[model samples]
Target: MINSKIRFVTALALAASATAVYSHGDVAPQEVDTEGLKELPKDEWLSENPYRGNKEAIEIGASAYNQNCARCHGLEAMSGGIAPDLRELTKFDDEYFVNKVRNGVQRNGMTYMPGFEDVMGQEAIWAIRSYIDKRHYEYKDKDLAELYEQAE
Candidate 1:
């Protein structure tokens, strides 16, 4: 009887653990509302982020990033070893950043990241980049509060 009970408990534990491990992957991607951002040409994808230092975009991007990216990228663009630290991407040009986000990373028949191009538009992507730029500045020991001032 005790052996059967132990087996039942072990099965329950495994089931719970599996749920925890796979829950994040099952989450549906949330839509970001880029209402106030300037509309970009739908056909022509800009190589550089036009909203790089825009304050409004940064605010919207923060919310968007938390909703869409925080699960894997960690809170505030920090990585918990699950994904690449987005702050490090600040060193690369905007073109490289956009391309990665648009195309995503895959290796050996495994998808490390999914492309957001279909779900997220250019404004949303650039806004997220702006927020990451802010996080990068903060990560580098720069004053967070003065980031916009410096940009100006």
Candidate 2:
């Protein structure tokens, strides 16, 4: 019985490791073109999201979030046991978003998230914020039972 229990534990560990390795590719950052977005001052950081309700921005933001954030944050801003559910974020709170993204969370000698300020421009980041905002509004009003039904 002891040997059987040890084998089960070992199998579970191997399965979890394999899943993590397979999903690692989805976590890499990708370049996004913010063509229609208005470029902000390079040295100046805006206090709020500039493209909150713009239709074009919503589209761009959706794509950008999928490319750079979906792996951890989950598809459509849902949390998949790896990262926070961005859908629960305060609506249009650009300051918090910007600061968090610019200076990623780190604690106890471990990096929880990496800073993306150097890799993505303000326009791209704001676009992602816009997408999260949209997703929040989309799912926030749904009944919890409905959500559970949809999940099935």
Candidate 3:
């Protein structure tokens, strides 16, 4: 009787442990609406970012990125070990960005990312790219030595 009771307790503990681990599953992607942004040509793909440096687009992009990408991509696109630092995408053309986001990426048997084409419009994705680009440029342009010297 004691052996049977021990087995039941062990099974219950294992089940609870599994439930806790499963709770940390993938985060759901947030939805973003690209209203108020200029629409791109439907049949044609842009080779370069048209919204680069656009004030309104940058603002919208910041918000959209925080909601949809901040978790994996890191806050301000700096990356937190789970994904690449988006600030390094300074010279990537618009087509590359679009294709990656639309199709996502996988390696071996693991899914690195999930495609957003079905849920997010092109404008929204482009805006996020723009925001990332802006952050990269700003960080690159900063005179770190000067700022450090000023602190003293």
Candidate 4:
């Protein structure tokens, strides 16, 4: 009886551990389609987002962000404690935004976020930034909690 109980507990523990390990689901980065946006120079990255405030770019960005970033960054650029709230990025300049997205975030040798420079071009990156910027402007006046409540 004692051996059976121990085995049962061990099996339960393994099941819980497996669940936790796979909790995040797929971690693969999805590709962003930047068609209809202007093509940027391939040789050098721009310091500022060229697509900023462009209506078509903003629309494309919304879809790209949802596909690639909404999982961790939260929907509509709001954060759920998993990642930094991207809307707060409005305080920073465009250069900072571009660099961060291209290079991604890393600390203590662990990749917090993977760099997209290899997979995504400047146009797509700028589109995502543009989308984030729009979200920032929309909620800049209202309380963040209010936005969260509205989302629910």
How does each model score on lDDT? 0.86, 0.79, 0.77, 0.81
Model 2 misplaced stretches (Cα beyond 4 Å): 1-16, 142-152
For 1-120, candidate 4 gives per-residue lDDT tens digits of 999999999999999999977876676766888888888999999887677677778888899888778888998989999998988876357898788778999999999888888878
Those runs of model 1 whose alpha carbons end farther than 4 Å from true positions after fitting are: 5-9, 22-26, 149-152
Q: Report the CA-based lDDT of candidate 2 relative to the real structure.
A: 0.79
lDDT of 2 by residue, 12-131 (tens): 999999988897575656778999777887998888887776666778989988888887788898898888888887654679888888788798989888888888888888888877
Question: Could you tell me the lDDT of residue 100 within candidate 1?
Answer: 81
Q: What is the Cα root-mean-square deviation between model 2 and the actual structure? A: 7.1
lDDT of 1 by residue, 1-152 (tens): 99999999999999999998887774566789999899999998999778877799999999989988999999999999999999987635789988988888899999988888988999999899999989998889877666676332
The candidate with the higher lDDT, 1 or 3, is 1
**TM-score of candidate 3 versus the correct structure, residues matched by position:** 0.72
Writing each residue's lDDT as its tens digit, candidate 3 over 1-152 gives 99999999999999999987775455677677677789987766677777776666778889988887887788888887989888888645667777888788879977898888877777888888778767877778954343223221
**Regarding TM-score, does 1 or 3 come out ahead?**
1
Candidate of highest TM-score: 1
Please report the candidate that would top lDDT against the real structure: 1
- Which ranking of candidates, highest TM-score first? 1, 2, 4, 3
Each prediction's number of clashing residue pairs: 0, 0, 0, 0
